[model samples]
Target: MFFRSSKINEFRLWGLLFTLAGMGLMILGTSGIVFWGQAGKIFAGIFMVIGMIAMLISVGVYFWAGMMSTSATMLTCPECSRQTKMLGKTDRCMYCKTILTLDPGQATQHPADTTQT
Candidate 1:
């Protein structure tokens, strides 16, 4: 639970970072950052392209995270007694970082998510 939560948080942060980077790159490319007449213009175009790609990738990552949220299993942490969502088979308590599982023997019997969107 904790691990999955942490990863989700990281992914969100990374998406924001990538968005910022793309904006920065686009700004730099549009501004007079490079000076070489035609060559400068070409460099700026390349930067713009790279920035667009980064923005697109960030959007995709965010979408993927949102989709995964629908299937997450929620459970109350025994250590911290707080509710948290588990993403994968290996999850920990988000509050106390305690390892959590469905069941030792029935670990493989975890239900598949049928919830859509």
Candidate 2:
């Protein structure tokens, strides 16, 4: 395995948060809570556009997170001895904060690959 999958879930959480925020903004825009003049209409339209963009971004993030989660490998951390999912080439034990790698060949690899995913 490369790195832990909770990272993917992190992205998923952020996506949900953004989706909710976007929906809230959309509702606020439609309610015209900012103002009542013609400028309010313009602001509302802008808000709606921005909210839509945020929702789209959230969707993309959710998709990416799902894909990553699928590829992630589950393993027991030697340090913590607990089950953890890994993402990239190297990752720290999510519980005990112990750095770990699934590939023995990577044990002596370059410093760049040692980065926690």
Score every model by TM-score. 0.68, 0.64
Model 2: how far is 37 from its true place, Å?
4.3
What TM value does model 1 have? 0.68
Estimate, for each residue in 1-117, the C-alpha lDDT of model 2 and write its tens digit: 234434655687789988998999898887774557666787789889989998999999999987887788888987668987777877666577666677778775445665677
Error of 2 at 98 (Å): 3.3
- List of clashing residue pairs for candidate 1: 1-91, 1-92, 2-92
What are the per-residue Cα lDDT tens digits for candidate 1 across 4-87?
454455567778888999999988887644566666787789889999998998998898777776677888987688887777
Q: By summed lDDT, which 10 consecutive residues of candidate 1 come out lowest? A: 1-10
What Cα-based lDDT does every candidate model obtain? 0.75, 0.77
Clashes of 1: 3
User: Which runs in model 2 stand beyond 4 Å of their true positions?
Assistant: 1-6, 27-34, 105-117
